[model samples]
Target: MRNNYHGFTLIECLISLFFISLFFLMLSGVFSQSQQIFQRVESREELEWQIFLIQFDKITEKGTFRDMSSTALIFEREELHEGKVVTLAIKYSSNKKYVYLSNNGGTEPILTQVQAITFDRQGDAILFTVRFLNGVEKVGKWTIP
Candidate 1:
């Protein structure tokens, strides 16, 4: 009796297959979770960047620099309402953690979760800074005659 069997036993093959399947299953789960995390991060970053841009764009238009402080800005915008000039007030409230724009006796918030806002002037350039709740900051500049 010379049985020269050179193949894996049925039980051994089943065990190997089970382990391989488990490993691949775990790998796919980890990859899927990581993908979700990455997507969320990307979306948050885009939203943060847009918050900065929208606030700055709103203020860069033609307006009289009535006054400004470390956390607020007051200006008379060159906008017309009912065939009359209008002035708008813009400011960042640390207490509420939001930026507000008010015009014609109406007030509304523009952005939220802002930690700070500052304005400065150098030569012909008006500079502004915005700080977000996550400790991120953005600086913007506009030239004025």
Candidate 2:
């Protein structure tokens, strides 16, 4: 008499499950790492764009008034307060690897990781070159009417 059975034994079943679980674990880890990297890149880009917008807005707000030096840019804003004309200064300081804003006497940092900054007065336009910590350089020009 002869008996024949075609089936996986208990040990064979356990080994197959173990290998499949290990493969899924490694795959999940790779996927999670990739997601983290992508998020980091996206956030950095968003922050940089926000900084760029703020810089441009503050500089170009009134169209035609500024005092600029090698390391600083100042904008004078005048508004009627309590029936009296009040003048305010918005100063941008390119110091300590940051772009700082100061009003009255309070100061705040608007941008960081700056490598260098240059302000050039070209006729009626102000051209600026900003160098970032990652060795990236950006040039922007604004006309002061």
Best by lDDT: 1
| Tens-place lDDT digits, model 1, residues 1-145 | 9999999999999999999999999999999999999788657856865875677566656567676666666777655556566777777777998778877798788767678888787877768787778677767776664
Model 1, global lDDT: 0.75
Q: Local error of candidate 1 at 113, Å? A: 1.2
Q: Tens digit of lDDT per residue, candidate 2, span 103-142?
A: 5567677666778878788998878777777676777777
Q: Runs in model 1 with CA error above 4 Å?
A: 1-42, 78-83
Best by TM-score: 1
lDDT of 2: 0.70
At residue 77, what lDDT does model 2 achieve?
A: 58
